[model samples]
Every structure is written in structure tokens, then in C-alpha cells.
Target: MIALTSPLLWYTARASGIVSLLLLTAVMALGVMTATRVGGRPMPRFAVAEVHRRIALMTMIFLVLHILTTVLDTYVHIGLLAALIPFTSAYKTVWVAFGSVAFDLLLAVTIASLLKQRISHAAWRAIHWLSYVSFPIAIIHVLMIGTDTRFPWMLLLVAGCVGTLFLAIAWRLWAHPRPDGALTAVPRRKGRPGTTATASTQHAPRGRKIASSGQTRKPR
Candidate 1:
């Protein structure tokens, strides 16, 4: 009974870690979807953007907790520094680096956004675009680091992320469809000769008016 319970607990922890990662990836994707203008449509509502931002921050918080718990459980030998740095992990250096890269990208984007007012809008906007890169890196990181990657449920999670992102891209492309109305020369109206005739000549008086005084009034 003790042996069985120990394995079950370990499995639960492993499952929780993957779940946390998946949620974080989803939060990142939501942020991207909200930031980008879809199909020539205006930006998402301020409320929507704010909600996404808050959710993303929460996701990050949960991710940190997840990492901490996983490390504490002792099932894996991941160190504190290893969690922050890429390619230093004992598990899989290259695949693990993907998570680190994603973390750096996410950090850049979050910092720039938080200091948007301090930085030039153009520069901030440029940095914010890194969110796109962050999202994909996050997905890759989860797929590689997750212990339950082979499970049917894990496969579904991966599919959902990829599918949603692809759909977003497709929608953006199809909705904005190239500017067909642009670059076409407008047809000029043809002008007729003598088109600017004088208005006074066109409205010439037919006859002159004359006034007559029928009687003279005495002055008071």
C-alpha cells in the first residue's frame, strides 16, 4: 500500500506541473489574441485587454509555484538556478532552453508593457510584439518538459494550443484580406467646353422695373 500510494502521489505532482504549464501557455495565447487586430477590426476592448493581462500575470504566478513545488517534491533534480537558466538542466538541455528563452521573451514583453508610459510608444510597441514569440516558445517548452507528454490528455492539450493559434492566424489573414480597394486610380470626370459661363449672363433680367408715385403726401 505504501509503495502504491507513493507512485500515485508522484504521478499527481507530475500531472499538476503539466496542467500549470498548459494554463500558462493558454494565458499567453489569449494575450496575443487580444493584442492583435483581427480582420481589419479595431483593437479589443480595454476591459478585454486588461482581463487578458491580469490572467497572464496570474498564470505566471501559478507557473512559478508549480516549478517550486515540482522541485521540492524531489522527483526531479532540477535546481533553483536551472529553472531560471537555459541549457543547464539535467533533463534535456536543448529542449529545456526553449522554456528559458520563452521566459526571457515574456519578461521583456511584460516589462515593456508595464513601463509603456516611460518608454517611447513606438519602442514599447515594438517590444510588445515579442509576445508572439513568447507564446510559441511557451508551447514548445511545455511539450518538452512535461512528463506526461505521451498521455492522451496531454496530446489533446497540445493540439488545442496549436489549433487555436493556427485559427487565429487564419482569421487574421482572411478577415483583413488584402486591400483590394487601394491602389486603383479614380476615374476623372470629363469636362465640357464653355462649362463656366457667367452666372449673371445666364440670369439676365427680362425687363427693367419702373416705380411711379400716384399722389403726393403732405409733410407733417
Candidate 2:
């Protein structure tokens, strides 16, 4: 017969899973903002990127805690191997498998990030894309097997996370509107009859050094 464990372990596992989800939500939203350069002079782009990294680290930590507690709790048959290998857990096999898959993807992403300097940029970016796939799988795992999902508050929390991430993506697409995410060019300005002026050319001060027709000259 399977031995029963203390309820504390169960509670801890549930709590850690919830916290991990919340942290993951924050990390995803911040990642979008970071990519889109949403921060202004006060926050700065680097600051936004740094915050995203810190929260992602926290999410991984809590995720580890959740897996450990679930394995230790004897209420279910989830073992250490079950935590890492998909479809191996006897309890809610499919749901647990989803969590395992998500974890594997997250682990890949984390390792790629840590070795970003050593790896080619294309490889790193490809690995990073797995994070987007992992996030939705993790959410599905939570909803499928989580006992708390029966509660209204838990459902609302999940909805909010999904909403926040979607909003961030929408803003990024709207502002960038390009695959490279470059800023749009400013409109050209008209100058004298035979000359063309752009925003840059119009702003030039008089007497700036220049070469025209192979002769050293200055702007009028």
C-alpha cells in the first residue's frame, strides 16, 4: 500500500506551482516589453532587460521547488524520474507530461541564455523561441491538474496572466510592425529646387565641413 504523507507537503507543492505561474507570467510580459524597447529614459532598455532576467530566474527557482515538493509528497505516485520524464507519472499522466515537457523546454531556454555569448546568435534565438511554446503548455498543465483551478480566484488569475501577455504582444506588433523591429523612418522634407532635404539634412548647422564636386566646401 502507498504510504500517506503530511498535508503540508501537498500545500507547499500547490503554493510553489501557483507562485511559479505568476512569476512566469511576469517574465513573459517583461520579455515582450524588453524586445520592443518599451522603457523610456527613466527605466532605460537595459534596466527592463535586467528585470526580465531576474524574474525569469525566480520563476525557475519556484518551478524547481514545485517539482521537488510534488515528488516528495507521497499522496501521489510521482517520483523523481516522473518529474523529469513526460507521461511517466501514474497520477494525471497527460497533465503531468505537459508540465514535464514545459520544464524541458524551459531548461533548454535557460541553458541557451547562459551560454548566449558562446553560441551562434541564430541558435540562441531558435532555442529562445521554445519559451513561447513552453509558457502555454505550462498554463495548460496548471489548469488540467491543479486542485485550485476549481476556485474562481485561480481561474481569474490565469485569465489575467494570459491577458497581460497578449496585450504586450499586441503592443509590440502595433509599434514595431516589422520583423526586424526597427523604428520607422521619418518623412522626408522638401528643400530648394534642385536639392533634397531630410530630417537630418534640414537640421544641419551652417559652415559644417563637406566635399562637393571634389572640392572642400561648407553648408550655406
Candidate 3:
């Protein structure tokens, strides 16, 4: 346990926590962009979605590192239980609880996304919305408990992240309004036989036939 008291661990915990927040903010922004189908001719929609997925993966990696380092750092004596359970940490109870809750929500959303193919779209979507709740709580957690937040540069970083996320959300809600007032995947256009060919055959007179070429001809 004494080995865990290294100053390196403390710095790693702080740096990883901050990076995780930044990555999570990017993920949220990209999610909003994907929902609104923001990328067009220059950047395809699929590319935006792919970027969102990759960034989300990176966010999870950094978050896990943050959690692990924080818990292992002997300076604070934060147990694994306190890391996972809300309102149980001896140090900064309320702020730690907020972090715990946000972690739980993000974990659920990640699991739901992984199993998205097996779950109902409604179920996946509902779980996914938890991200919105988790993010603000996470910001609160950082503001209340983070030691580095006192720095002006850190404050500006947080502000910029918050501003970017809000701008994306506002653009999504106002510029891309949907009938249900929810962000959803754009419906895909299904390919089908030529409209004119299908129409000509379906509406052919009783004595006429639709040739293979889709032209009307007298019955043989």
C-alpha cells in the first residue's frame, strides 16, 4: 500500500480525471452532431459517427484510469467501495457521491450501447439519455472536489468544454427540430425497383402486359 503513496500516482489521478472530462465533452458534442446529421458533402455522416464511437471509447479508457488511480492513491484513502457507491466516501462525501453516480450512469450507458443489437431501440435510447444527466453531475463533481480547478487555465478549459457542448445541443434542438422533439437517427431511404416500371406493370390494362423491359404490350 505504501507503494501507492507515490506522488506520481497523485499527478496521474488528476491528469487522467481532467482528460476524461475533456474526452467525454467531445463525445457529447460528436453525439449531438451525429444526431443532427451535421456533416455533409465534405465530411460524410458515417465519418462523424465513427469519430463519435472512437472518442467515446477513449473517454471510457481515461475514466477507468482516473478511477483506478484515485482509488489506489493512498493519500486520500478512498476505498474501491467509495468509488463505486454514492455518498459513502469519507473524503468530500457529496462531491464524491456525484462522481460515483455519474460513473454508474456512464457505465450503464456503455453496457447498453454494447448490447444495442440485442435490446429494443427504446430501451437503448432511454439508457443512452442518462449521459445527459451524468455529464452535469460530473462537472459538479469536478468543480466541488478538484484541486486544480482553482487554476485559471483549468477554469477556462472547463468553460470551453461546457460552451462547445451547449452550442451543439442548441443547434441540434433549434436547427434540426424533429416531430417528436427528440434527437433520432435519420431514417434511411430504402431502394426499390424503378418507380415507373413498377407503376406501368401494376396499372396495366386487362388486355395488356408489361414486357420485361417495362413497356406495355398486347397479351400474346
Candidate 4:
């Protein structure tokens, strides 16, 4: 339990908010990179995915603490319901609504992710994209509601998070576009391996015709 008059509570809340933003940024960046299968020797695709998941869990923790501290602070009129319900806060109602919106979206994304194994992949994926909404709303909340936004360092931080995510999304779209006539996987027979040709292969060379005797018949 944090003391209402303690400056430590205020500082902790601010720090947690900043950390949550950074973690959210990392989660989003790595998510894009993972979806695009971006990786190198030092880090593989699986590693990127693993890091993204762990960071998401951590982001949730910090976010909880941030909300707790905000509710605990006597300096603000923000209440518990305000955190859970949008536009209920008496202080900075509009800007705080952004946080509320982002929080709800992130909560949905997290819950859907936890039940991913039980749910259809398409459903999980559809809800998981709410993180995209969560990120921008969080960024906007921080920018408009945060006391540090006037500082150059904070501005740079905001710019960096936005710029990096924007570039990553652009790169992902450019690298993995599904334009018409895009090259798709070479379809394999239903029961056949999709890899190298095998003895029971069905596909043959364009001009070749195999006879029942396993001999190439003349192209008459």
C-alpha cells in the first residue's frame, strides 16, 4: 500500500508509466518483426517471438502497477472506476479516456492470447491486433496527459517509439505484401510431401509422359 502523501508514489507511478510505454513499444516492434520472420544469427525468429511474449507479460504487470499508483495518489481525483471505465475521470477526462481505451483493448488482447490454444487461431489473431490500437492510444495518452511531455527527452522518446513502430509496420507490409498474382507455395498432393520429389510423386516434367510401365512415352 502506497502512502497518499508520499512523493515516492508519484515518482513510481510516472516511472511505471514510462516503463510500460517502452515495454509496449518493444512488444509491438518485436511482434511486427516476428510476423515478418525478421531475424539474424544473434537472434532467431523463435527468439524474437519468445521475447515478444515475455515483454507482453511484463507490460501487463507494469501497467497494473501504474493504474494502482494512479488510483492511490491523492493528488489526482482519478478513481478505480475511472481506470476501468472510460471518460469517468474528473481530471483530464478526454486524455485519460485514451488510457482507458488502450487499457481495455490491451486487456482483450492479453486474455485472447492466453486462451489462444483453446480458441481458433483466426479469432485469437483478430483480437490480438487490438494491440495495434492499444499502442497508439497509449502513446497519445502519454503525450497529452503526462507531465513530462514538455521535456525534450520525453518528446524524443515519443518520437522514437512512434518512428520505430511506423517504420516496422511499413517494412512488414512492403516485405510481405499479398498483391494479386503474388507467388504462392507450390501446392503438393494431398498425401504427398511438399518437399523434394519422391518415388510416388504425381507431378512430372512439362513435356514428359509416364506410361504404366514406368517409361516415358513419346509425345505423339
Candidate 5:
């Protein structure tokens, strides 16, 4: 005997979920770009890293809202434990467990990032790898949930997300970087000799202790 307006809760949950997915997409793309150290003319490498962090934070915010609204809605019975513990929910049990798994991985990534300074680099990176796996698991969770999959637009959205993620990963892997990301060695043509004389010299002018112009030359 619930009110008609309860649909609003479900709608809010759906919207937040989609928004979080988009934010996660941006975060993943930015993270890949950060690794490649590539950026647009206006956005530098550091800015890319900064935007990645900010978008990840925003993604977490929307994710929290999505989880809360879904649990709070009276239409479905999603307990607090279902959100934290996998395979414990009675509703869409398997799909919900996937979401829960993603949530758990995300929690680890967030905590590890916050404690980065305290934790060793290898440990932090090991925990962060969960995020890459979590992204695809979340997509599968949504697809299997049967929420918006019936709509053509929803299918297109999921396809776009998958395509974007694959392309981002490909670019990240294909782009090679110079050692230390620096082009220190000068390039030469195929027929170039052992060395070429440069116009510039490192030698300083011997002015201070030199003999005057009128001074006679001494035999060495």
C-alpha cells in the first residue's frame, strides 16, 4: 500500500546510477591519459591527473546516492548488508552481488588512495588494480539487472561505454613513451658521421689572466 510517488525514488536511483557510470568513464579515461602523460593544448598532464581525482570523487558521491536510494525505496527490498556484502540480497541476487563486489573494490581503492603516503607504492598499486576489474563488473551488473536494458537508448548507452573503455585501453597500451618521457638524445640521419661540430662551445673566454695585446709571446 505505497504511495504513487514512490516511483521517484526508483527514478532517482536510476539517474544517479547512470551519472555515476558516466563519471566513472571519465575517471578511467583520465587515468589512462595520466599514465600516458598526454593532454590537450589547454589541459596539461598535471591537470589531467587532477581532473581524474576530482571525477573519481564525484563518481563516489553519485554511487553513494544510487546505493542509498535503491535501499531506501520501498519497491524493492535491498538491505544495508546487501550493499556491503555480496550475494546476500534476495532481489536480483546475482546482479546485486556483482554491484556489491564493485562497491567493495571501490572502497579499497578509495582507502588506499587516501592512505597513499602511508602505504608502500606496490601495495597501493595492487589495490588500485581492482578498479579496472570493477568497472567491467559494474557494467555487467547493470546489464543483468534488467532495469533499463529494455529501452533502445539504454542499450546504446551501454554500448557506448563499452566502446569508449576498450578504445581508451587500446590507446593506453599502444602509445610508447621515451625513457623518463624525455627525448635527450639528438637524432641524426643514416649517413651521419661519428660526430658533427656544433656552432656552440662550452669553453669560457680566457680573459682575466690573459696577457695584454702588446705582450710578447713566450716560447713553450
Candidate 6:
């Protein structure tokens, strides 16, 4: 148990936590891109959305573990209450609070999602929209509170978020092409065999043919 409290262990836990958070953010972004419908064309694969959701859930799990381990470490003086409350940490109050706020939003979204079947569809949808809110909050939290924010790896993480969102928007526009009502009805050509009013009479059965005088003709 002492090993878990060591500085080395603490660093490892924080690293894992950051990576998990990044993964979750990417997954959630993918979900948003997939769910959007522009002009009636949807993203190609349902599996992509499912994978995103599942990976996010897993990320949350790892995050909880990361928090627990970090708080338990004797080297770091984070209190349990501080973990839940915003701007209450003895160390880095302002930046740490960002993480607290993000954590709360994430918890709310995860719980609501798990209970979706029990909740009304409208209510669930409204809460689900909060996932977008959580994503940016999480990003801000990492940017502000993360110990290695200045590192090259951290820069890559931020870039990944921007790149993925850009690609998603571009792909969405390309896939859904809308027509301008130009070809609603095809025009009929003149002098065609079946085009004129007389064509109906010409195609009538022999027994039911009408005479030129408008009387029905008897079968021969």
C-alpha cells in the first residue's frame, strides 16, 4: 500500500488519468459527429458511435480509479471533500476547480445515460446534450490543472481534439448533398406512342372499344 503512495506511483496515476480523459474526449466528439444529421444524410457507421460511447464509459472508470489513488497518496494533500467541491483544494484552487466542475458534469451525464430507459425520452435527450458541455469543460480542466500542460505530449493531445472535430465537420458536409428541386417531374415528349389522349382509346380491349361517334362497339 505504501508503494501506491510513493511519488513515482502518483506520477503514474496522473499520467494514466490524463490519457484516459483524452480518450474519453475523443470518443465523445466522435459520438457528436455521428449523431448529427444534416439534410438527411447520417454518418456511415453505427458501430463508430457505439465504440465511442463504450470507450468513454471505460475512460470514466479509469478516471475514478485515478482520482482515488491520487487522493490516497500521502505526498499529495488533496481532501475527499475537495475532490467533490470546486475551488476548495489547498493547492491550485482556481485551476483545480475546473476539474471539479468537469467531474460533476461527467458524473451527471454518466448517471443519466445509465438510467435512460427509466427516464422520459425528452428528459434523457436534454441531459444527453450535456455531453457536449462536459467535453469542453474536461478540456479546460486538463489544460489548466494538468501538471504536464507545457509538455510536447500535452500539445499533441490538444491538437488531436481540434483535428478530429475538423475532420468530422468536413466529412459531414461532403456526405450529405441536397438537391435544389430541379428534377421533381420528368416531362413527357410529343408524338410518343402512348403520349396523347387518343392513346387510351387505341389501347382499349377489342370487346370494350368505343366507336368514333362515342358509342361502345360490339365484339365481332
* For model 3, the run of ten residues with the poorest summed lDDT: 179-188
* lDDT, model 1, position 136: 75
Runs of candidate 6 with Cα error greater than 4 angstroms are: 1-4, 37-44, 169-220
Q: Against the true structure, candidate 5 has what lDDT?
A: 0.78
User: For model 5, how does the per-residue alpha-carbon lDDT over 1-220 read when each residue is reduced to its tens digit?
Assistant: 4423388889999999998888888898888777776654567566788899999999999999999999889687888888779999999899999999988899899999999999999999999888999999999988998489889999899888888988988977776642233111232233323222322111113312223332222223
Clashing pairs in 6: none
Task: Give one digit per residue, the lDDT tens place, for model 1 in 1-220.
Answer: 1112256545655665566556655665555455442112233345445667887676666656655654555555666677778788896777767877777777787789789889999999888778777777877877876777778888797888778777766755566633331212222233333222222222113422222422222222
TM-score of each: 0.65, 0.79, 0.79, 0.78, 0.78, 0.68
Q: The CA-based lDDT of model 4 is what?
A: 0.81
Q: Write the per-residue lDDT of candidate 3 for residues 1-220, one digit (tens) a residue.
A: 5646778988999999999999999999988877766665566667888899899989989988999999998888788999999999998889999999999999999999999999999999999999999999999999999999999999998899899999989888777643232222343333343223332344335545545566544455
- Tens digits of per-residue lDDT for model 6 on 21-100? 76776766666555552222233345555677788788788777767776787676777788779988887787667777
RMSD of each: 17.6, 7.2, 8.0, 6.9, 11.1, 13.1
Q: Which sequence of candidate numbers ranks them by lDDT, best first?
A: 3, 2, 4, 5, 6, 1
- Looking at model 6, report the run of 10 residues with the lowest lDDT sum: 179-188
Over 47-146, each residue of candidate 4 has an lDDT whose tens digit, in order, gives 7788999999999999999999988987887889998799999999999999999989999999999999999999999999989988889998999999
**How many pairs collide in each candidate, listed in order?**
0, 0, 0, 0, 0, 0
Query: Which runs of model 2 end up more than 4 angstroms from their true locations?
Result: 1-4, 177-220
Pairs with backbone N, CA or C atoms under 3 Å apart (clashes), candidate 3 = none
For model 2, residues 1-220, the per-residue Cα lDDT tens digits are 5675788989999999999999998999988877775655467566778899999999999999999999888878898899899999898999999999999999999999999999999999999889899999999999999999999999999999889988888888776733322222333455454343432332333534334422222444
In TM-score terms, candidate 3 sits at 0.79
